[model samples]
Target: MTTITQTAPLGDRTVRRIGFGAMQLAGPGVFGPPEDPDAARAVLRRAVELGVDHIDTAQVYGPDVVNELIAEALHPYPDGLVLATKVGGARDERGEWVRASRPEQLRATVEQDLRTLRTERIGLVNLRRQVGGPEPDAVPLAEQLGALTDMRDEGKLGLIGLSTVSAGIVEAALEITPIAEVQNAYGIANRTDEPVVDLCREHGIAYVPYYPLGSAFTGGPRALAADPAIASVAAGHGVSASQIALAWLLAHYDRMLLIPGTSSVAHLEENLAVDGIGLDDEDMAALDRVAHLGAPSF
Candidate 1:
């Protein structure tokens, strides 16, 4: 197997490029606890075994589900593994996601994430802002980032990030703190965050794309699997369509970090194997031409 060597500096910490997303470890409804606790643990263990050094999770995934699993499965974690978790969202009684970016809530979530991940300080914490929500305007970006900065000083966080943010929000964040990474949805099928990805690249910030594969709104499974161009490329390489999709993203950006989530070990292995799939210039050009077919809206 060809070992893909992609690295980026997170303020000062160096992390591997291909990361693991822990959201799928939760139950059917992401708001509730995981259906199979053992499966969650096994997935995490398998991630480390596969050489994934970066693990992404959020306090709202089960509002606590996935982080607890990480602690249980990999406490006393291997050296050089970066455990990143996010805050700023919570679940309501009906299992609906609610945005909570207030300073107090931010602080509370950080504390809980640290405790659940069994770490003195999280390697990274993404402050996920709700898109088209009323709250973003209410809380000044400075105040929100300042809270994270204070926590960093207190040794609760190593690096800070922003999710679902625009270029303007990213600029505002840099004024307060050194934005280490930016997580947004950017893939072959969804290019809404293209400008955001470009901005991160220019600023030397890692662009960690959440849904490098199509998300629920982006015509989900059938759309991705049945993509004619992707199928052709996969056939040429003797790999799965999902592998073709991920490889395209990895080759698209220099600082791109992938966090493809899956509950199945078979699927996880397929996703990781993307690093081994090579796409030359001709292959990339061909894929690029067909990439916009049925592209998802923001």
Candidate 2:
């Protein structure tokens, strides 16, 4: 059977491997406030109650909407809770993601997060790069790290992280500062970021897959939870396909910390129940084959 430890060291703190992502707490398009603010708050509280110590969010998510919700839901955050937010971007009037990786821009963004999050300091801040990847001409990766480093030095941020970046970018950033974690679009079927994952393991950095359940945003493919292989495995285990997908991630990487997001208390509880659902060698083998199972593997 493939078993995984429940907690992993994140900087000085150890958080449950299955954490919470605050992106979905916002409204559609990740813009504006959620339709049901009370319901969203309930999900956040329930996650913590279920022992989710790592919460990932960003200032750009809902253009400060999610951060505000987090504060409203879980202010005076419980001890051991790690609040991770992303920088280097923002939402425009049309709710589109735009790069703001300049050093000054990053500094301003971190300061803004402190205000909205209602905290003296943020636990983690990932420098979310541009869609097409890093452009040296726009703003060198070093400059972005420098901006974050300065804040880290001043005690405004606990540990620096990176998102949507290449292994080369991680290498470059390492020379400037120690990365506590890396968040990217990775899942059982979407194994394109394998190289980055290998690099993270080499350096002891925690790997957090943003869409562990897969996403429709990535070229509008079917959800990974709907994959035939995953569904079959779920049936054998008598659990949701979502649980099988998340369990595979934990079993696959010891350092992986999942931040699967949801806005409902029921789904939140279902996600938290992923712990102790053992996946045997046969199940692991079938899931391991998901990445190469033809088109729309999800």
Give the alpha carbon lDDT tens digit for every residue of 53-154 in model 2.
899988988898899999999998999889999888877789767778789989999999999999989999999886433454268888889889899999
Off by over 4 Å in 1: 1-4, 131-137, 216-221, 291-298
Report the C-alpha lDDT of model 1 over 1-298, residue by residue, as the tens digit: 2234577676678876778888888886676777789988998999899888999998878878889989999999999888888777778878777777889889999999988888998999898876335455467788888889999999999899998888999998888889989988777766768899889888999888877777644555446668777778778999887788888888877678899888888888888878778887767776775545343332
- The number of the candidate with the highest TM-score is 2
TM-score of each: 0.93, 0.94
Clashing pairs in 2: none
Q: Return the top candidate by lDDT.
A: 2
Tell me how many residue pairs clash in candidate 2.
0
